[model samples]
Target: MGRHRVAIVVLSGTFVLDLAVAAQAFGRRPSVFAKIRHEPETPYDIVLCGPTAAPTSLGFTIGDLSPVEWIADADTVVVPGLEEPWAPQDPTLLSAVAKAAEAGARLVSLCAGVFVLGQAGVLDGRRVTTHWALADEFRAAFPRAHLMEDEMYVDDGQILSSGGMLAAADLCLYVLRQDHGQAYANDVSRVLISPPHRAGGQAQYAKATTRPLSGSLSPVMHWLIENIAEPLTLQQVAARANMSPRTLERRFRTETGDSVAGWIARRRVERARELLENSNLTVTQVAYAAGFGSTQSLRRHFVSRIGVSPRDYRDTFRSTPEQSRTVGRPQQGPAGTPACDAGPDARRPGPFSFMH
Candidate 1:
C-alpha cells in the first residue's frame, strides 16, 4: 500500500514543541525498527507546509517549507498550536485548511491549533478538545463547536483534536494506531518511550487542586495498584485507608476526578489489556487474572472501556508465532486492521463516564 500522506500546517508563531511532536511521530521513521525482521516500515509521508521563512514562537525561522497548496493533496492535515492562537491567521492557510476539509481529508489539531480549525469553519458541530486553559476562549470564539474541555483528546470522525503540548504525542500515536494497529503503535511507543495508548477520554493534566493526591490518598492509590488483581470492594478499600466509604468517595472525586469504582474498573481494564497483549492466556483466564469475576464481566468492561471485545483486542495485539520466536525480545508482528471506524460513536464512553 502507498504511504499515508500527512501535511503539517505551519503558521507564524507556531509552538515549536507542537510542530516537533507531529514531525517526530510521522516525519521520521525510527532506525531501531529497521533491524527487526518483518516489521512494517513507517507508513507516513510527512510534509511541513507553510510560507517560506516562517518565524516560530521560539524566535527561530523555519525556511524552505513546502507551499501551503501541498495540503490539498494530503490524506491527513495537522495543525500545530500557535503561541498566539488568538492572533489573526493567514487567509491563504485558512483557505487551504478549509479546502482540505471539504476534500474529506482527516483534520487534526494539537492544543490551540483547534482555533485554526474553528476559524476554517470545519469544527462547527463537531466534538473537539484543546488546552484546558484555552477552553473558555475556544467556546467564546466558536460557540457552535462541542468543546470537550476535560478530554485529553477528542476523535470526531474526520476531525481529531488534542489538548496542549504532550497530548500531541497522544493524538499522533492514536492516529497511528487507527491507521495501523496496536502492535505497530506499541513498537513505535516503545521507541519513543511513551505509552501506546492513553484513552482520549482521560482527563487533561489540569491543576484541579493544590494537592492532587493528598498525603492520605497517596498510599491508598499505591495499595490499590498492588492489589489490583484482587476483587476488593469500596468498603474494603475505604477501611484499608481508615475512612468511611462516604468520606473516601468524596475524597476520590475531589482528588482524582473519578469515583472509587470507576478508578478500579479503569485499572482492571488496563490489566486486562496488558495480559491480552503479552500473555497467551485464554479469555476466561485473562478475565480472572485481571480481577473480573467472569469472561462475561470482562467482556462487558472491556467493550465499555476499549471499544472492542477482549478476544478481538488480543487478536489484534498478540504477537505472532514468528514474532515470539525472536530471541531475547518480542517483535511487533504484522499491523492489525482497526476493529471499528474512526468515528466518535464507535468508541465507548469517556473514562469519566465508565461503568462504576
Candidate 2:
C-alpha cells in the first residue's frame, strides 16, 4: 500500500500543542522498526493546510504553510484545537473542510476543534466529544451532534473527536492503530513514550469532583473502590448499600453512566495500572492485588479496558531508573521546537469558540 495523505487543517489561532501532537504522531517515520522486515511501511504523508500566515495560541506564526486547496488530495483531514474555537471561522476554510469530508476523507477533531467540524456541518448527527469544560456550550451550539460528556475520544467510523488537549494524542494513537496493526501502534507508542491505546470511554483527566454523585449512592461507590479485590457481585453490593439488586443497578446507571459490573471492572483496571506504575510487583501479584482472580483474568480485563497487556503496560510505564529518564525525551521537529503532545494552559477557553 502507498502512503496515505493526512492533511492537518491549521487555521488562525490554532493551539500549538494540538498541531504538534498530530504532526509528531503521523508525520514521523517509524525509524525504530526499520530492522523488522515484516512490518508495514504505509506511513502517512502529513500536509499542513492553513492560510498564507497561520497565527497560533503560543504567540508564534506558521509561515509559508499550504493553502486549504491542499485538502483536496487528502485521505484524512484533521482539525486541531483552536484558541478561538467557538468564534466563527473563515468561510473559505470552512468550505474547504466541508468539501473534503463530502469527498470521502476521514474527519477528525481534537479538543474544541469539534467546533470547526460542527460549523462545516460535518458533525451533524454524529457521536462526538470535546474538552469537558466546553461540553455545555458545544451541546448548545450543535444540538445535532451527540456529545459524549466524559469520554476521552469518540470514534464514529469516519468522523472522530477527542476530549481536551491531551486527548489529541489518544485520538492520534487510535488512528494509527486503525491504519496499522496493534503491534505496530504499540512500537510507535513506545518510541513516543505514551500509551498505545487508552480506551476511548475512559473519563477525562479533570480536576476533582466539583459535581457530586446524584444521591445517597456515594457510600456504595466508595465502598466498592475500597473492596475491589473481593469478588463482590451486584447482589452483594446491593445488600451493602441497603438497597435491592434492581435498585442498585438503576442507581448505578443514573449516577455513574455505566453498569455496576462495568464500573467495578474499570476501577479494578485503574488499580492495576496504579500498582504497575508504582510498585515492583510481579504481573501475577499485581493481578491478585487489583481484584482479578488470576493472571489470565487480569490480562483479559487489562487488554479490554486499558488497551495493553499487564506486562507490556508495565514495560512502557514502569521503566527502570535509567530508562525512565530517557523514555520521555521529545522528538525533534523541523526547527528547534520539541515535537510533543503538550497539555493545554490553565486559562479557560471561551465558549462557542471557532478558528479564524
Which residue runs does candidate 2 get wrong by more than 4 Å? 1-8, 15-52, 65-78, 83-87, 103-114, 125-214, 321-356
Clashes of each: 0, 8
Q: Report lDDT per candidate.
A: 0.80, 0.78
| Candidate 2, pairs of clashing residues | 84-354, 85-353, 85-354, 86-352, 86-353, 86-354, 87-353, 87-354
Which candidate gets the maximum lDDT versus the true structure? 1
Q: List the residue pairs that clash in candidate 1.
A: none
TM-score leader: 2
lDDT of 1 at 90: 78
Model 1 regions lying over 4 Å from their true place: 36-40, 199-204, 209-356
Model 1 TM-score relative to the real fold: 0.58
For residues 204-295, what per-residue lDDT tens digits would candidate 1 score against the true structure? 13433223445568899888878876767778898998999999999999888999998888888888888877886656667768777567
What are the TM-scores, per candidate, against the unseen true structure? 0.58, 0.60
